[model samples]
Target chain A: MNAIEINNLVKIYKTGTRAVKGVNLTVAKGDFFALLGANGAGKTTIISILIGLVNKTSGSVKIFNYDIDRQFDQAKRIMGVVPQEFNFHMFEKVQDIVATQAGFYGIDRVTALTNSEEVLKKVGLWEKRSSIARTLSGGLKRRLMIARALVHKPEILILDEPTAGVDVQLRFGMWDYLRELNAGGVTILLTTHYLEEVQQMCRHAAILKEGEIVRLDSVKNLNKLIQQETYVITVRNMQPLDGIQSYAPVVIDEHTLEVNLNRDEQLNDLLIKLIQNGFAVTDVHPKEHRLERLFLSLL
Target chain B: MNSQWIAFQTLVRKEVARILRIWTQTLLPPLVTQTLYFIIFGKFIGSQVGPIHGISYMSFLVPGLVMMAVINSAYSNVVSSFFGAKFQRNIEEMLVAPMHEWVIVAGYICTGIMRGIVVGILVFLVSCFFTHPAIDHIGIVIMFIILTAAVFSLAGLINGIFAKNFDEVAMFQNFILVPLIYLGGIFYSILKLPVFWQNVSKLNPLLYMVNGFRFGFFGFCDVSVIFSAGLLIFLTLVLWQVNIWLLKNGIGIKN
Candidate 1:
């Protein structure tokens, strides 16, 4: 069963601002699902709805076969959220912060404390457990958020912009930790601006534009959409176009030339043709489609 | 009494800790500021006016100071906490939680009340520095202080919900609260006012809180404290409903 199911979810603000038009998505259990979009895109809104924060205007949200409306408690039980913003008590200690989140899941104080310690260690913040939440650095604060979210051991974890301002090293560290958790059977719903992170971490992805789900597919399938592989060649000279008949039509701009190739094109043949034409190929590199370019093209 | 109550309690604890963690700012500053009002106005100004009802001028001024502490701290706690949540964009955590909307409002409100009462009690204790403290009815005094804290806290939460920037909270504090607290007959009895001004003072809802609290100390009041308590309670329920509606509708949280 899918860990979380959202169908045509819509949210319209009171001031009549339609934040999320309608989004439909399904995240299979234990799958790492990436929800990708720009700043004003409906990623946060959709995440908020799944976590039961923002009330949906229309549409059904189901978690574990329990509808959010009829079985809100059941749905809430299995969902853990790491909000994009700092949500911990600023004056609270790291341990207390994680413990409080556990308490929200009906965990007793003793177990919550034990769980907090274990999760804090998992995030490498165990040494800073006694430190106040506001006193920690930005990256540490984000890690603390992650630890707190996992304290309850929820079946599904939702992270909204989990790595927004963290340093590169810390970002990868978080991704590693999240991947480990996913391997342990925890479903993860990640919303992030860094497309590379999605490509590296998530196997399933949903692209949202202006509150609508423009595309949702397996990471492999999405990558397959750009069927023609790309290659950029910086030749010594741009001879007459007829000299290179083997290569597909090339787009030329300044010193660089880019060509689109069919999936079955032989790389060796193309390279040999360029070499024999009296033009030295300074650089010949195959380029895979980037999520950013695909995203821009969709927009 | 598990998740909902526990979450509410955790939020309240966070709120209280935020204020008490920095007692110099939360509890002490307001106490010191209220003392200046007592020294400058009650001691110096009242010596010339003489006692109002066998009560020393400083004694009469204590209730007003305590009420001021309650109202100011209560309002500031909710206004600042809610606005801080908004400013930091942290309210999304609670907004996205499985917990219901009212729990969030109540949690913030309780924190406001705790801060207000703590500051109010501190001011009440500090009043002893100037004059002998008197409590004609201990129960009434406790009830008055608690009810005052709850009412003002709810009002402050409402303000926090509607506030967009730091200035909006300040606008309510500067324009609405200051005038209301002053005209509420904090310094003098409402009956002492000229007939026209007495009716005008009656229009300020804060007058009931101040007068009701004063009656708690002296057992003497111009307005009915029961009516005041009931009215304040009604306003609190109304604000609570409104706050929950605002949250559920994503009035400010969305975007």
Candidate 2:
């Protein structure tokens, strides 16, 4: 069953801004799906409409076969959302925030508190449960939101930039937790600016541009659309670039070179040529994420 | 046991917790203010004024002061709390939940009424320190208090829905609510007013509330008890419907 299905969705604000225009998309159950877009690309708008936060101008949205317009209560029962902004009460305690969210989903107090404890422990926030939300750091607050969203054990989790503004270490930690949830059969729909995250964790992605989906495919297939990749190579010995010029190698310093390799070009062939030319390669890595390159190219 | 019932209970629990958690802000001020009213209005001022309807002025002032506390507490609780939720964007929590719109409205309204009754009881106790007012009709007193609180609670929800900012929230209380309460015969009998002004005072819905509550205490009222109670019930239903309509349309809370 599809976790979410949106058809010909349109949203025009009262100011007459057409935020989302005739967008159709679906996220299959148990799929780790990424919705990629730049600012104002209607990513949040689409999510907002699905959650019934914002009224849709036209079209239909269904969650797990429950229509959002006619069966919102049923649809909302199986979906959890981590909004783009922090919306929980700042004055509330961490535990209260999560348990209170469960209550809104019609969970009893005892069960809600039990679920809150489990989710808080999973998110590493059990110790901070008694603290006021505003006292927590940004990363902990993000984790608290994740815990709140998961307290109801919804089948689908929708997160908007869940890792944005988090430190690299914490970002990786959240990714691991999300991966565990996805592996446990939770359908995850995420919107993020971190292209590296999408490349690492998302199986399929859809890139939205100007209120429309411009690309939708598996992550591996999307990576294939990149015609070229730039790599920063660190060498122990400087090479006189004579034979590797076809790769358009640019010398960054005495021991470092930047090179662009076409999709058909082999990095092994280029490295061998460099080795033959007296360059002892110490390290080679892409200067930018492959998905980021494709994403930028699409825009 | 039902999910919607559970949701409603949770909302009420959260609201009650908030009211108690901030008792210094929500519950204390009314107690202090009504104590001052009993001292100044009933004791000091009533000493100079003659009795109305053969009852001491201080005794007559008791019910009005208690009703005033109920009205203000009920109205302010929902307005400040709901608008605060909107301003902080935390209202989205319930907006995205599986509960019906009427559930949201009832949750807020129920809590508003709770605060009103709590504050009303406290003020009545404080009034006891000043004078022993008779409860002529206990049923009428309970009915009037609950119905009055419900009416204002609904009105407060409407105000909260339309309020765009904190200033707008205070604007309704100060400009509209305060004026209506003052003109509702809290201190003076509308019977003392000229025939024309008495008719104008009758138009103020709060006048009926105050008079109906006062009738419960002394068994005397400037307006017919039936008319006052009927007006209170009518206003409650009308305001309740208005609030439900606002929530259904997502007016002011959603875009």
Candidate 3:
């Protein structure tokens, strides 16, 4: 069964604005799905509709085969949502937030407490469990949200911009934990502006533009649409390669040389040319992320 | 069903804890204000006004003051707390959860009722320092107190659901609730009013609640116990249904 399924979903604001216009999408069970969109592209409206925070104008939404309109409680029981905004009581203690969320799922106090501790420890917030949420930093708050979402042991985790303001270290740590959760058979649906994270984490992706899915495919298939890959080669020392126009290399500062090569171009040929030109290459890496190129192309 | 109970308890606990944590704002102000009313209205002013209905002026004022505190606390508790949740957007957490709409409304109203009763007890205790209020019908007093709290709490929930700002909440308390309570005959019996004013006082729903509560304390009221009890019950049922409808429709919570 699909973890989530939306058929012709539409949302029209009272102000006569059509936020979402008949969007149809699906995420399979145990799959890591990415819903990519720019700001005001109706991503949040979709999430809100599924979670009962926003009323849908038209369409059907089913979670784990339960209709959202008719079986909301059953649908919600198996799903956890991390909304884009921080929607927690700021004055509440860290431990209380997670446990209260578990209680909302009808979990008993003993189980809620146990789950809270487990999730807090996993998020590296056990030491600050008794502290008020307002005292935590932004990254810690994001982690707290993740911990709360996980406390109920939901089968489907829907994260909307989960790491929007998190630092690089915390972002990677969260990514690792999410990957571990997915590996453990949790279906994950994520929306994020960072295309690199989508490339690394999601197997299937759908790109929404102006309330419509303009592109949908596997990450590998999306990457196949890229006609060329840009490579940034780091040289051993600072050197001026101003006359190297044949490769159209952009000499960035002293040690970096960026070159764009088509799909048919050979890496060895570029390396041999650089060697013959008396330039020492220390390392070479793709400059543009695979998902980033595909994302731009679709937009 | 068990889960629904658990969720309800959690919401109630959170609401009560928040109010208790800010006791100076929630508990202290009402107690202090009621004490002043006891001193100024019952002691100093009552000495000049003398007795009405064959009871001391101080005793006549106790039940009304207690009910006044009950009304204020119950109304403010729900309005501020619910609006605080909306302003902070924390209400979305409950909205996105699996709990029933009735559970959410009941949890908030339960908190309001709890605060109302607590404040009523405190005000009554303050009144005790000045006068011994006769308990003509303890059961009637308890019933009216609970019903008054429920009615105002439901009204507050409706106001909170519609309020878009803190100013709107204050407007509800000031422009609507305060005038209704004052004109409800908390200070003087409606019998003291001129004929036309007496009829006008009857239009204020709060008059029935206060008179019903006074009947419980002194066994005397401008209105019959049956009329007061009937009106209170009818209003409670209507307000409850209105609150439930608001929650289901997501009037002020959802876009």
Candidate 4:
């Protein structure tokens, strides 16, 4: 069964702002899926609704086959969330905070304490167990968020910008841990501003623009967001390479030239031109579609 | 079955510990403030001002001072803790959890009550150094204090829900709380007011709490103790429901 199914979801704020406009999505159980969007793109709003924090104006949300709006408590049972904001009791000790969250999920203090210890150690917070939450560094706080989200052993996990303020090295480490979690059969949904994160981690993806789902498909399908292709070529000799007219080669310098491709375009035309021009071609390379181009397209 | 209960207990304990950690700010400040009232209006001024209702003015003012401290601290605890949650944005964890929303609210109110009662006890201890105000019924005074704390804590929950920013919270405490407190028969009995003003003062909810608390001390009050307890219970229930709705609907929070 799909971990989360959002069908024609519509959300209108009480102030009359229509934030989400009929978004439909189905995230398969255990798949690492990325919800991509720009600011004000309704990504966070959508996540909030699924977690039961925001009420939907209309439509349905089903988590693990249970409609969240109709069966809130049961749907919430299987879901865990890591919010983008660092929202926790700052003055409280880390040990108390994590254990309290476990207790909410019905874990006893004894078990909660043991589990909290293991988890805090997992996030490198065991040494600072008694430290106030506010005194933790930004990176440590992010790790703390991860530990809290996982305290209940939820079947489905949602991370909202989990690596936003983290250092470059820690970001990679977090992604690695999440990858391990995903491999362990927990369905994971992530909303991120970093495109490369999506490229590396997600198997399926969606894009939202101005509160509308502009794209939704497998990771490979998202590559289609960029249509035109680019190819770069290097030659053994530099000569009058202008004859490569059919492939539209632009001679960038003495050794390098570039060509843009369409579906019907053939590379033979450029090879024939370069051979005829006495420019011995040594290498021909095609540049794959990049997220930067896709982002620019969405904008 | 007991999971959520444990969660609730932990939340309450954490909240209580937070206030206890800052005992000076949370407990001592009210005592100091109330002592000023004892020195100025109770002893220094009571000597010049004749007896009030056949009792020393100092004895009469003690109940009012105690109730006021209870009301203010009770309301302040909830408003500040919840608003601090709103400010630091930590409340999101509880909101998104699998736990019930009512549990979160109850835990918060419990924290408020603890602060209110702690300060009340401190004020009582401080008052001992002044006039030895006789307690006609210890049970009745404790009951009145609990009811007063409950009602005002619920009111503070409402304020926390509706307050949009820190400035708005300050505005509520300053404009609404301070005026209502002064006009609630704290320093003077409503009996001294003109008939029209006396009738109006009776309608002020704080009047019942203060008068009932006074009944606990001197066994004399403007109204029946039963009536005061009843009024406080009614206010507590009404404000409790309103607070629940405000929190459930995210009135000013999510917006």
Candidate 5:
């Protein structure tokens, strides 16, 4: 069964704004899926509908085969949601915040405490268990939300920009933790502005534009849709680029060069030509993230 | 236990913990306020007035003061706590949970009742320092306090549902609740009012609550004790149903 399935979802606000316009989507069980969209593209609205925060105007949503309209209790029991905004009591202690979330799922106090401890420690917040949530740094607060969502041990984890304000180091750590969870068979659904994260962690992705799905495919398949890519190459020794002018090479500095590879061209061919010209290339990387380039082009 | 029961218990526990955690705000104010009422109204004011219904004026004021505390505590507890949750958006934590709407309603109402009873007891204790009022019917005392608290708690939940800001939450208490409680015969007997005002005072639901509670202490009242009890029970049921309907409809909590 799919972890999440939506058919013709529609949400028209009372203010006469059509936020979501008949969006259809599905996330397979145990798959890491990314839902990418810009602000006002209805990503949060769709999520809110799934979690019962917003009443849908029309459509069907099923979580693990439990229809959200009819079997919402059963659906909610197996799903954990990390919303885009921080929605916890700031006055609460970190431990209590997580444990209280477990309690809301009907977990006993002893079991909730145990789960809280495990999830908090995993999120690097065990040491701050007694600190008031407002006292935590922004990154720690994000981790605290993650811990609270996980304390119930949900089978499906839905994270909406879970690493938005996190530093690079903490974001990478969170990615590793999320990868571990995915490997452990928890179906993961993510929405984020970080296209690099989509390329690194998501197996499948869908891009939403103005409340409609514009593209949906595997990450690798999506990357292939980009017909050309630009790379920044750092050379060990400066040399004349007359041999590589076919690739439109631009000299950035004494050691750096910018080059573009089209659909029929290969980086190996360009590197071989540069070497034959005594360019002595030492480092090479894409100028922009592959998925980011694809996303921009699609939008 | 069932999941609904567990969820209810958790919500109640969290609410109760919050009340105790902020005892200075939740539990202490009523005690201090009632103490001032006892000293000023019971001692200084009652000294100038003679007994009514063959009971001392101070004794006559005790039950009414206790009922007033119960009403205010129950109403404010749910209004402030629920509105605070809505304001901070943490109410979504429960909204997205697997529990039924009634579970959430019961959890909040139960905690409100608990605070009401606790504050009622404290005010009663403070009253004891000024006067030694006899309990004519302990059963009626317990029944009336709980019933009145339930009614107001349900009303408070409705207020919390419709309230958009802190000012709205306080508006009901300041403009509606205070006038009703004062006119409910807490300070004097409605029997002394002129015929038209006596009928008007009877229209106030709080009068029945205060008189019902007072009947428990003195075994005397301007209205039938059974009638007052029945009115309170009826109000409780009606308010309970209203609260359940509001929650199920997601009247103000959901988009």
Candidate 6:
């Protein structure tokens, strides 16, 4: 069964702002899907509508074969959301937030407490369970949100900008946990500004623009859409190199050069030429990530 | 337990915890204020003005003061709690939950009424050190207490739903609610007022609440107990319906 299906989803605000415009989307069961878009591109609106936080002007949404509006209880029962903002009570204790969320899903007190502890431990927050939520650092707070979202054991998890302000180490740690969760057959619908996150974790992706779905495909297939890729090369010499000017390299500095390569180009040939010309290459890497290139192209 | 039951219980538990957790703010102020009212108005001033209905002045004022504390606590508890939830945007948690609107309203009302009753009981206990006023009608007293709390709790919910900011909330309490309560016959009987002023005081619903509760205490009231109880019931039903409608429409929380 599909985890989520949205058709003709439209949300027009009171001021006539068309936040979402007849967007159709589907996430298969157990699929790790990414919804990518710029700010105000209707990413949050779509998630909000699905979760009943916002009323749709016209549309249909179903989760696990349950209609969102008609069978709201059933649909909402199997879904958990990590909103873009920290919506939990800040004055509340960490464990209470997670346990209360489980209780909201109808779990008994004993089961909710067990689930809360398990999820908190998994998120590395068990040691701080008694501490108030507002005292946690930004990275820990993000993990707390993840724990709260997962405490109920929903079949589908929606994470909207879950790691926005998190540092690199903590961000990657969360990525590992999410990967493990997805591998355990949990469907995850993620929306984030981190292109690297989508590139690493999402198998399928949909990019939205101006309240409309602009691109939807597997990550690998989307990467194939990029006809050219740019690479930044660093040389040992601090002076300009000789020869190989036909490739139209832009000198970033005395020792660095930026080169654009078509999909068919051989990087080894260019490296051999640089070596033959007595320019010792130190490093070479893509200027932009593959998903980032695609995302920018679609935008 | 069922999901609906669990959801309702959890909401109520959270609401109660929030109220009790801030005891200095929610529970203490009412007790202190009521104690002062008993000392200053019921004792010092009442000793000078004497009593009406052939009872001591301090004994006559206890029920009205207790009811005032109940109404204030019930109204403020729901307003501050719910509005705080909205201001912090944490109300979205319940909004996204798979619970009925009535469950949410009931959870809030239960907490508000709990605060009201707790404050009323504390205030009455404090009043005991000054005056030994016996209950004349325990049933009517309990009835009026619950009815008044329910009415004000629902009204507070409505005020919270429409309030956009802290100042707006304060405006409802300061300009509308406080004035109505003070003028609701807390200090003196409406019979002492002139004919026109007495009729004007009757227009305030709080007057009926105070008089009904006073009747419960002394069997003396300016208005009929039946009329006061009927008015309280009618307002409770109307405000409850209005709150349910506001929640169904997603007034201030949804855009």
Per model, the share of native interface contacts recovered reads: 0.38, 0.88, 0.83, 0.60, 0.82, 0.74
Q: Against the true structure, candidate 5 has what lDDT?
A: 0.92
In model 6, which runs have C-alpha deviations exceeding 4 angstroms? A238-243
Q: What is the TM-score of each candidate against the true structure?
A: 0.87, 0.99, 0.97, 0.90, 0.97, 0.97
Model 4, position A54: C-alpha lDDT score: 84
Model 1 interface RMSD over true interface Cα atoms: 2.8
B75-145: candidate 3 lDDT, tens digit per residue: 99999999999999989878878988889889999999999999999999888899987798999999999
Model 5: CAPRI class: high
Q: Is the docking of candidate 1 incorrect, acceptable, medium or high quality?
A: acceptable
Query: On residues A60-119, what C-alpha lDDT tens digit does candidate 4 reach at each position?
Result: 999999987668777876888999998888888898889878877777778889989988
- Model 1 chain A scores worst on lDDT over the 10 consecutive residues at A246-255
Q: lDDT tens digits, residues B1-255, model 5?
A: 688888898899889988998899999999988888988988998899999999999999999999999999999999999999999889989988897988988998999999999999999888888889799999999999999999999999999999999899999999999999999999999999999999999999999999999999999988888999999999989988998898888899998
Superposed model 4: Cα runs more than 4 Å off: A224-226, A231-292
* lDDT at A85, model 4: 90
Residue range A1-299, candidate 6, lDDT tens digits = 89999999999999999989999999999999999999999999999988888888998999998998789988888888899888889999999999888888888899999999999999999999999999999888899989988888889999999989889999999999999999999999999999999999999999999999999999989998888989999998854455777678889988899988888888898888778778889999999998898888888
Error of 4 at B138 (Å): 1.7
**lDDT measured at residue A204 in model 3 versus the true structure, 0 to 100:** 94
Instruction: Assess each prediction's global lDDT (C-alpha) against the native.
Output: 0.82, 0.92, 0.92, 0.84, 0.92, 0.91
Report, to 2 decimal places, the DockQ of model 4: 0.56
Please give the lDDT score at residue B59 for candidate 2.
89
Question: For candidate 6, lDDT tens digit of each residue in B1-255?
Answer: 678889889998998889879999999999999999988998788889866889888988899899999999999999998999998888888887788888888888888989999999999999999989899999999999999999999989998999999998889899999999999998898899899999999899999999999999988799999999999999989998888999988888787
Query: Considering every candidate listed, which one attains the maximal TM-score?
Result: 2
lDDT tens digits by residue: candidate 1, B1-255: 577887787677667767867878778889789989988987888788767666777888888889999999988888888988887776755654566777888888888888888888888888888888788988878877877788888888878888899999899899989988988888888777789988888888888888888888888877998998888788777877888888766676664
Clashing residue pairs, backbone N/CA/C < 3 A, model 1? A53-B95, A53-B96
lDDT of 3 by residue, A113-134 (tens): 9999999999999999999999
- Report the TM-score for the A-chain of model 4: 0.83
Best prediction by DockQ:
2
Candidate 2 lDDT, A81-179, residue by residue in tens: 998789899999999999999999999999999999999999999999999999999999999989999999999999999998999999999999999
Question: Where is the poorest 10-residue window by lDDT in model 1 chain B?
Answer: B90-99
Docking class of 6: medium
